[model samples]
Target chain A: SQQGEEDPQALSIQEGENATMNCSYKTSINNLQWYRQNSGRGLVHLILIRSNEREKHSGRLRVTLDTSKKSSSLLITASRAADTASYFCATLLRDATNKLIFGTGTLLAVQP
Target chain B: SAVISQKPSRDICQRGTSLTIQCQVDSQVTMMFWYRQQPGQSLTLIATANQGSEATYESGFVIDKFPISRPNLTFSTLTVSNMSPEDSSIYLCSVGAGKTEAFFGQGTRLTVV
Candidate 1:
């Protein structure tokens, strides 16, 4: 079953603008990760935030997790045209198998 | 970090024909996973493969339709059997350390006519 939903199915922004995408999941998670996919290619891992941690950052990407709310968000600051792609949030359940459940993605189009 | 190589980056197949996608990892890994992504949609995990064991499939997926082989820790394959137009989608292989980040293959895009 699909674990989560991402808000703003599609987003359009200009270069240097900030883009934010949100994800909400159901079950308890050990960690939540952000990934980027250009066109229809493979996914590139961005950053991961553990349930025990509130937020994480890498380069121009910022991710925040709220366990109580069962939601998380990814913010890209000073976005560039190269950042235009589909962003996804995946959850690693605390269960034994350690399978990663991916959420519905957010498509961000950064216009140059 | 693991480097994964997947074969047949894209293919156009006739209905009723089957296609097998292979995934090879640079290093040995315990668990591997397969996922399917339909057009303009999110990825849905098909199954989890453990070396020397039967693949554990998720709901709405069957071993007969999508058979998996984990012959060893560094290699695995997924075959889409009795292919149909509905089966046309991008298939990806992934591997990860326990509860950590995952590494993905380039993905095989299958289009059935």
Candidate 2:
């Protein structure tokens, strides 16, 4: 079963703009990670934020996690045409099995 | 981080046929997972494949329909049996790395006719 739901199922913007996607979950999680998939192919790992941390950044990507609300958000600053892809947020439950429950996903289209 | 090599990147099969997807990891891992993504949809986990044990399937998925084999820590296979057009989707294999991050293989795009 899917644990999280991402809003703004689809978004369109020109190059150099910023895109923000939100994800809300149902249960407590140990950590949250974001992944990007291009053209329905393989997924590339983006960033991971642990429950102990509220925010993290890597280059143009920023992820914020709020344990109290069981939500997380991904901010992509200075988006490019190459940034057009499907973004997913997956959560790792604080359990023995390291299974990840994925979010619905947000599709971003960056026009050059 | 573990690198995975999945065979048969894409295939077109007829109804009632079966397709087995393979996932091989560079390093031995404790847990591996299989997921299915329908057209323009989110990923749904099919099962958790653990080495030396029978795979544990999720709700709405059965072993008879989607059988999984974890022969070793680094190799696993998922077979879609008695496949129909509804079984057509992107199937991906993943392994959990340190800090609970997942590494995925290039998905297999199955198209059933």
Per-residue accuracy of model 2 over A10-33 as CA lDDT, tens digit each: 999999999999999998788899
Determine which window of 10 residues in candidate 2 chain B has minimal summed lDDT: B95-104
Error of 2 at A96 (Å): 1.1
- Give the per-residue lDDT digits (tens) of candidate 2, residues B1-113: 88999989999999999999999999999899999999999899999999998999999999999999998899999999999999989999999844857999999999999
My TM-score estimates for the predictions, one after another, are 0.99, 0.98
Off by over 4 Å in 1: none
Could you give candidate 1's per-residue lDDT for residues A65-88 as a string of tens digits? Answer: 999999999999999999999999
lDDT of 1 at A100: 94
Give the top-scoring candidate (lDDT): 1
C-alpha lDDT (0 to 100) for residue B73 of candidate 1: 92
Relative to the real complex, the DockQ score for model 1 comes to 0.76
For residue A10, model 1's alpha carbon misses the true position, in angstroms, by: 0.4
Flag clash pairs in model 2: none
